[model samples]
Target chain A: QQPVQSPQAVILREGEDAVINCSSSKALYSVHWYRQKHGEAPVFLMILLKGGEQKGHDKISASFNEKKQQSSLYLTASQLSYSGTYFCGTEESTSYGKLTFGQGTILTVHP
Target chain B: DAGITQSPRHKVTETGTPVTLRCHQTENHRYMYWYRQDPGHGLRLIHYSYGVKDTDKGEVSDGYSVSRSKTEDFLLTLESATSSQTSVYFCAISDSEGLYSNQPQHFGDGTRLSIL
Candidate 1:
């Protein structure tokens, strides 16, 4: 099943911070995050395996909580270039290669 | 940039017509995927292939079909185009074991389809 993302939309200042959360009902093998600017394909950010691992890229970080069947993405010291739609893709136990993505969180970073 | 190219970046077709979108990868990855994006809904997998001639349906597989006769090409066909099918389509590729790891997927720019 597809995961659900909270705060469908968020606005942040250039130096502000925000968090986007994703939750799934089924057991997951991994959680992958991607960001998409307008009129472009989703760009991969990071992936969290089922073991509750934390991965970071620059000012972005994410944590996967297997027990809660959820993952959260953290964006700190936001920049204008960070504005875009973020999506979380979940890998189910039964479908190893198949990924189900959440609706998405639109983050708009302002100056 | 990932050696993935989707042909006919923009397409416009009449409803009920047959439309085929092609995805080509130069990396020779064993796994290829087709996905569609719509407002209020994230990228939904249409279908994917593990290897040549091997394929499986995804969550929203209706009204769509795929073929992978070779290693570098994966084709998605809209049996009959509909207004609801108007959306951007993405093609992704990954290595055989990358599917089980944190390996990121490489995506093509995308194909914008409009059904009139």
Candidate 2:
């Protein structure tokens, strides 16, 4: 099943922070995050496995809670380049590599 | 970006016609997937291939078929294109060695298809 993302859209000023959450009804083995700019391919951000580990790169970070089937993406001190549609993909334990992505959260960072 | 290429980046076809989108990857990944992106519905999996000649259906596979004759090429076909099938198609690849492996999927630029 597809995951659910909160705050369908968010607008933030440069240097502001925002959080995007993804939750699934079924158990998840891993959560994957991607950012897509207009007319561009989705770019991989990070992936959190079932061990409750938090991973980050630069000012972007993500956390996965297998027990709650929830994952959150954090953007700190947002930049203009961070304006894009954020998507979270979830993989179930039984699924090999099939990922069901959420509806997406549009993040707009203004100057 | 991954070494994935999708041919005919943009296409327009009439209803009932057959359409095929090609996905070629140089990464030699073990798994490949086809997905369609529509407004309000992020991305839905259409089909996936685990290896050459090994493929399976996904969440939305009713009017689609896939083939993986070689490790580097995966093809997605719309048996009979319809207006509802008009959307952006993306081909993703993953290097997961096994079913339980945790690996990130890299996506292609995507093919924009319009059916009238």
Candidate 3:
């Protein structure tokens, strides 16, 4: 099944903070996060395993809650470069190699 | 763009015509995928490949087919294009499963297709 993303769209000023959440109705084996700017392909951001791993950068981070079947992407001190849509794709243990993506969250960061 | 290239960045075709999109990768990743992106719906997987001649269907596999003749190239074909099939397509590769499943996927620029 497709994952659900909350806060369909949000506008923020530079240096602000924003969080995007993704939840799945069924159990998830892993979660993948990606970002896409206008007219560009979706770029990989990070991946979270069922073991609750949070791979992140200096400003961007993500957490996976295996029990809740949910994941969250956190953009702290957002920059203009963070303006784009974020998508979360989930992999079910039973369905390997296939990922079910969320509807996406549009985030706009202005300087 | 990690060494991945998608041909015909933009295309406009008519219904009932055959359309084939090509994805070429230099990364030599073990896994590859084809997905479609629309306004409201996020990227939806159409097909994917694990190795040469090894392909599988995805969630939105209907009306579409795929072929991986070589390790570096995966192709997505629309047997007969329809207006409903008009959308931007993306191809992604990952060093996933068969090798490592936790790796993130790298993507190509994408193909913008429109059916008239």
Candidate 4:
């Protein structure tokens, strides 16, 4: 099944912070994050394993909670370039090579 | 960035006509996937191939068929195009070395398909 993402949309100003959450009903082996711009494909951000490690790229970071089967993406000092739709893909233990993604959270960062 | 390319970057077709979208990858990844993006639906997998000639249906596979006769190419076809099929199609590739490995997928620019 596909994961559920919170905050269908969000607007932020430059240098602000925002968080997007993704939760699943089943146990997840890993969580993958991607950002898609207008008329563009989704770009990989980072992947978090079941170990619950926190990963960051530039001002963006993410955390995976194995117990809760949830993941959150954190963006700090948001820039206008960060404006896009964020999606979280989940991989279950039984699903091999099949990643289910959430509906997505639209983020608009204004200058 | 993974050397994945999708043909017919933009297309507008009439209803009931057949359409095919091609995806080619130079990375030689073992896994290739076809997904459609819409307004409410972020990205739904239509079909996928694990290797040459090995394919499987995804969640929203109805009315869509896929073929992977070669390892470098994966094709998604719509037998009869409809307005509902108008959406941006994306092709993704991933190389998972081991069963337990966590390999992220790389996507192509995407093909904008408009069915009238």
Winning candidate number (DockQ):
2
lDDT value, residue A38 of candidate 3: 94
Give the Cα lDDT of each candidate: 0.90, 0.91, 0.90, 0.90
Please give the DockQ score of every candidate, comma-separated.
Answer: 0.75, 0.78, 0.70, 0.64
Worst 10 residues of 2 chain A by lDDT: A51-60
Per-residue error for A76 in candidate 2, Å, reads 0.6
Docking quality level of the chain pair in candidate 3: medium
TM-scores across all candidates? Answer: 0.95, 0.96, 0.96, 0.94
Off by over 4 Å in 4: A53-58
Per residue, candidate 3 scores C-alpha lDDT tens digits across A80-108 of 99999999999887777788899999999
What's model 1's lDDT at B72? Answer: 99
- Where model 3 places Cα greater than 4 Å from the true spot, the runs are none
Docking class of 2: medium
Q: Report model 1's TM-score to 2 decimal places.
A: 0.95
- The residue ranges of model 2 lying beyond 4 angstroms of the native Cα positions read A53-56
**Native interface contacts kept by each candidate, as a fraction:** 0.83, 0.79, 0.71, 0.52
lDDT of 3 at B87: 98
Candidate 4 local lDDT, residue A32: 92
DockQ of 2: 0.78
Instruction: Give the TM-score (vs. native) of candidate 4.
Output: 0.94
Q: Where is model 1 more than 4 Å wrong at Cα? A: A52-58, B96-101
Q: Estimate, for each residue in A1-111, the C-alpha lDDT of model 1 and write its tens digit.
A: 879999899999899999999999998888989999998888889888876664437667888888888999999889999999999999888786889999999999989
